[model samples]
Target: MYLVKIIKLALVSGAIFIGVHAFAQDDNNKAVVMGNFQLDGQYYLEDSAISAVVPEETMALSGFGNILYRKGKFTAGMRFETYLPAPVGYPAGASWSGTGIGYRFAQYSDDLFDITVGNFYEQFGNGMIMRTWEDRGLGVDYMLDGVRLKVRPSDWSEITAIYGKQRFNFDNGTQFVSDDLGQGIVRGINADFDLNSLLDSIVALPGQLSIGGSFVSKFQNNNSARYDFPENVGAGSARLKYNIGGFQFSGEYTWIGENPSAQNAQIVNIPDSLDPSVGLWATGKGVNLNGTYSTRGFGVSITASSLSNMAFQSQREAGAFDSWINYLPPTSVLQTYLLSQLYPYATQPNGEVAYRGDLFYNFKRNTTLGGRYGMKLELSYTQVNSPNIAELNDLGTSRNGAKIDLFDPGDEIYFSDFNAKLTKKFSKKFKGILFYQNIVYNNDVILGAYDYDNVPTKGTVYSDLFVFEGNVKINKKNNIRFEAQALFTNQHLQDWVAGLVEYTVSPHWFFTVIDQWNYGNGDGDDFHFPSVSWGYIKNSSRISVTYGRQRAGVFCVGGICRVVPASNGLSISITSSF
Candidate 1:
């Protein structure tokens, strides 16, 4: 029986870690147990395309360790992890090897009131709707396993409550029913206020204001009632923030319920028996979606900012990572390196909506066009859709219309980006930057049309990039930095060229070199990726080494993406802290 349920869950997690370390050593007041610890390990040096899809390439290791404790006001923690043969894109049914004690908690607070139980991580307000957090190299975790409460009843009110069960990967054993086995619950509550002290007693206002609201619910149990689902799945949110001084503004709105996702299913091909009369067609048994969305923000003064319709997720697989949610109110604009790689978009927990904005300005130190200078400009936009379906027909005649195509629904993923930059300082060993970028991509909804190794063309994709970055200072320990990029795509892989160089010898050591060239692909072997690295940082400990040629795309973290295969050599990393 699975080794007696793993030895009774390791004897109930070692008697709850020895009864919370013997009640913190019988409370003996000598308080001061701060905490800090870290360890990271990696080693790999064998490649047959990563050992023929990781059939075991001689060496692989993963580790995590944490132990925190604070005295007065009480606080406790635990985290320990190990993955003997876990690497090469991790998650392949996980559990390559295991070790327990993955986050245990206890907390208490003063100055008002607060409490927490087993595991906890929470977020409301601009979290768009809800959030639960944890991010382990993007493996992502939705930590929530019970009690939590908070209260503050004075200087502007505060309240919260939560109850739960969520944390899926890591051994995959507690889904707590519901697949029709009944018993599945999740609940939440929230409040925050200080609406500028009720709008300054109903009058004078120039800034400062806050308001919040939240309510979340989920309970599962269904006998598949001919498909009516929604055994309670609720959502509600409202928030507003305003400030005046360097400017700031915020907004939020959310609603959810009708849940029924699996991308809304729409598979049909039934006929093992049951035949009505050869003219019997009745497809569309899934997809009944609707989950409202709204997010807004505005800013000025220190430049400008604007945002709208931010999408958020608490589970339903919470985008896999990009970093633990709790809220991710920024819709687009993350862009970094490689033609702004597409990333963790996975939150469609049943529906979606999105929006984003940004702006910054600084220039007025030396004249002649601020030539001692600085300049920056940015723009972003995003859109997503697929909800609201119900259209079935066949026998009763409706012209063969059979809705519910949700899975991959009405396709339309969006993106738009613009950037401009210029910075210069000629003294202190020179410094420079000049950048330009323009991007628009849809690419059949961000790749995944089987990643087009089978060519068809035009699903919307455009790119333009130009960059020149530099830094040089030969004194005080030596330094050098440089980068150049140029990419202009025509469709898929039509143009790309990149370069980087780095050298730093400060408190420790550093060295790096990189190259990427795809130079218009008509299949002339235009793909080449190169890399080299060396690092050693003392004072807390750090180590790094690399030799490479890696390229295989798709490695999203947070919308959960994985599909990396293409390797070519030595790598090592070690980190330590105490």
Candidate 2:
């Protein structure tokens, strides 16, 4: 009822504007219009064996369309979203199952200033202090619903400010208030400066230098009486970057004020007793550093970070990816292979130190190591550990959390992984990649309660994963690919093996089938998870239908994660843009 009117209005205005300007003699009368849409629907079937059942609703649909209009310095866009009985395990609760104008924004800009109202998304340097963005795949659409302003005062300086409310997601579809606009009102300011552009004569070098800073604060009324939490939580971050030809380095440091809520309990469990006033939310701080070097076919990067009580959420009681005020950059490798992602690491925001290093090189052709074609090698290693923690005793009335040394090594470890890959092309139509990985995963911390009862040792999981991918082009119009993956472990879930085969016909259609088997679970309850998908593509439009048994696993982004439930169903998706 509401978004329909806006759509009609937009269509009418677009038609009028185009009719009056497209034929105008003026060269600037180039009215621009573009739109994109996506539809995802699923038909749930009851299969007690795989735990896939939809009692109340047999099917579900989720779709959205974004229409944008731009004419010279003026721009406007609107997003329409609808969800009918949202899919299972889609963290965003059921209250979002209605058609509405999810996002709308209009902006006018020139050489000096840009302004937007209604809705927008923005991020500060490295997104350490504040970032308002969206990830449809993760059900994270926390875009800001307010006004944003940006200005370039000089050639070397830029400033941005925003006052908005986050997009609140109902934890589930059934019971939630219509607080779709978010629960907290947040305000933030960010600025960046380039020293080289401001003063070139003083530092006349072949490199570049830049610095940026951000300050963000979110205000939400506190209702808890047990703990006196701050209604206004403020976080600030500063970042610096410099590059000289082949070498580059960047870092960001952030400080956050104290605020306690659900994840960071007001009462914490220590050695023997519970400290009511001490939790992970007691005045936190974090720092992230990264360095990179590249030469010819050789490139490498190293990233390190320390997080101490750095969990910042708009609503202290929110769960999953809801009402997030700020994001913490993760230091783990984003695995692409199937087996590598089986026990992927998620960032620990409370107190942890993490680091990752990666190197890539391509050997020259006709060499001893390289055959007719060159061979490519990639190596990556990542590790994360708990921060050094010690008690802090102030006045009897003023009890805070423990003090954490950012760089000091702690005894407890969260996760660690080391992986390497080698890729080579034998001929014009064939290529393959071989990979190996070793991972030390702490299921206690990552899987939380889901794995606590499942793990027998109540300890860490030592596992190894191997993967091989080969692809071939069977002519100008046909292509084929295959994948073989295996994971070996002595802990929970034990060993798993997976295989995939895919065939694609150029410019149109593709089919794929994959099967994953948990063959060494120690328990005789081994299972098989298989799926098949067919996809078609035409221009900017594409559609795919998949019928499969989905395995339950932890999906993560940055340092945050959401659990996907196991189900067996038919899913269809279509996307188009014009």
Candidate 3:
């Protein structure tokens, strides 16, 4: 009976495909369909050794699919999402269960203008003043739902405008329009001009030059009982970029009006006073500068930023992962090795002064230092500190926060990292990398979690890490790679070592095994974490499965972070694009 049903389904599918192809051939304007899908599910298990808990549901699943339709100059798309009692550590609240349309939009574009209505994402001026975006790995989505317009008046100039509300949470089976939107309304406009092109008719210049500016505002009803909030908050930014030869320079400055909310309440008012004008309700500002010089095999870059009370959100009461209006890029580089990420840093939005520098050099082959194969060397350093704040009291004796100096670095150091890496190619099929880093992490300031298991982390923790990685191409179809890492620290979790082995059968199959051991615990109760996984890839689809004990730690991507709970589970992931 099953075989007969399968045959019937195949025949019907073939008939439909043939009919569609003939219809397309008959019409000049044929419609095209494209989309992608992904699913992540985990089945938990009880593990006393790792303090892993199995929830009442026993399993958790999250998935989404996007379908897009396009013709000539018009396009439309929608996304379907489901959380079935979201995965552990997911930012999606309890209300995000069941299935619903997460996003939908219709857009039209031509040489003169482009317009979008429904849902969209955008960024302006390094994203310091406004950025509506999402990162699935961090479980953060701030996509705007409304209308976006872009106009190009000339080849050298363009303008963009937006009016929208940010997506907050999904209500099960509700109307897809504004049911899941935030309470505040947002509006913005931006203009960019290419100076070189604009001045070409008047004068001939060197290199390239460009300038842009943006103004964004958010509106929300004032319902606070204790403080008088601004019904409409506004922010503006200006940016400039210049490039000549192999050198590039860019900078942006953003300023926001006085906006007080729950996140900055500590510094919003004096220690015992509530008068809005007496405290740090002063205007906020952010300045970012970047410069890069690259030529041949050597290059260098520098980035510096200063921010003071610059955390802006569409709604004053929104949480950290919701309704965010701006994005502050981090100064530290992202780590690739798993163990190196244990101490990843997050950008501080309230007030911070940060700097980062990087240097890269490559040695030519047939030299004393480069050997028969070429070698590459990389060095980087990053530091972050709190901006100085003055007191608001009469005598200035009490430590009541008042005004902030953006360039002033206070005594407290939030985080810092100094790292170096060397990559060498010993042969055509052999390559190796050696990396080392020294990190200073302030748990009290960074994680805001001072204690673990009744033991305090003692404010600041210092650690040194080393990694050794090698890869070998056994043949045309097979490859193997291995990594060994060690982290030494006296505070927090203490000393640890980890190793990973991965094998790949070229084009389709791969397997990996990894383990971490904490052997320096003071209580003599050491712990070991192990995991294994296998994956297969074909065309545009891939699937993988892993079963192991996961340690409780912080996971971060692009300066944003989320806490991942300890779990012993069988996990599966599938993704496809068509």
Winning model by lDDT: 3
Give the distance in Å from residue 271's predicted Cα in candidate 1 to where it truly belongs. Answer: 36
Task: Supply the global lDDT for candidate 1.
Answer: 0.56
**Residue range 1-578, candidate 3, lDDT tens digits:** 99999999999999988877676675654888999999989899987665675767999888889999986578899988887756776764425567788889999988899999999999987888899887654567778889999999999999999999877766553232232233668899999999999999999889999999999999877655655668799999999999999999999999999887545553332222455334435678899999999999999999999988888888765666667788876778888887777777878877889999999999999998898998999999999997887756535433245677788999888999999999999998999999999999988777822222423266788989999999999999999999999999888788888899999997999999999877776543537779999999998999999989877667765446666667888999999999
Which candidate achieves the best TM-score against the true structure?
A: 3
TM-score for all models, in order of appearance: 0.28, 0.90, 0.90
lDDT of 1 by residue, 27-112 (tens): 66334544343434444454442232333544566666677777668888877766565566565532434556667788898778
Please give the TM-score that candidate 3 achieves against the real structure.
0.90
Q: Which stretches of candidate 1 lie over 4 Å from their true place?
A: 1-67, 70-132, 135-145, 148-217, 220-229, 233-337, 340-458, 462-485, 491-499, 506-556, 560-578
Q: Which parts of model 3 have CA positions greater than 4 angstroms off?
A: 1-29, 92-95, 173-182, 266-279, 394-400, 448-456, 523-526
Q: Select the stronger candidate by lDDT from 1 and 3.
A: 3
Q: Is candidate 1 or candidate 3 better by TM-score?
A: 3
Backbone clash pairs for candidate 2 read 93-170, 93-172, 93-173, 94-172, 94-173
- List, residue by residue over 190-261, the lDDT tens digit for candidate 2: 999998988876766568999999999988775545556688989999999999999999999998898675
Ranking by TM-score: 3, 2, 1
What lDDT is obtained when candidate 3 is compared to the true structure? 0.81
- Candidate 1: worst 10 consecutive residues by lDDT? 283-292
Of 1 and 2, the candidate ranking higher by lDDT: 2
Q: What is the C-alpha RMSD of each candidate to the true structure, in Å?
A: 27.8, 5.2, 6.9
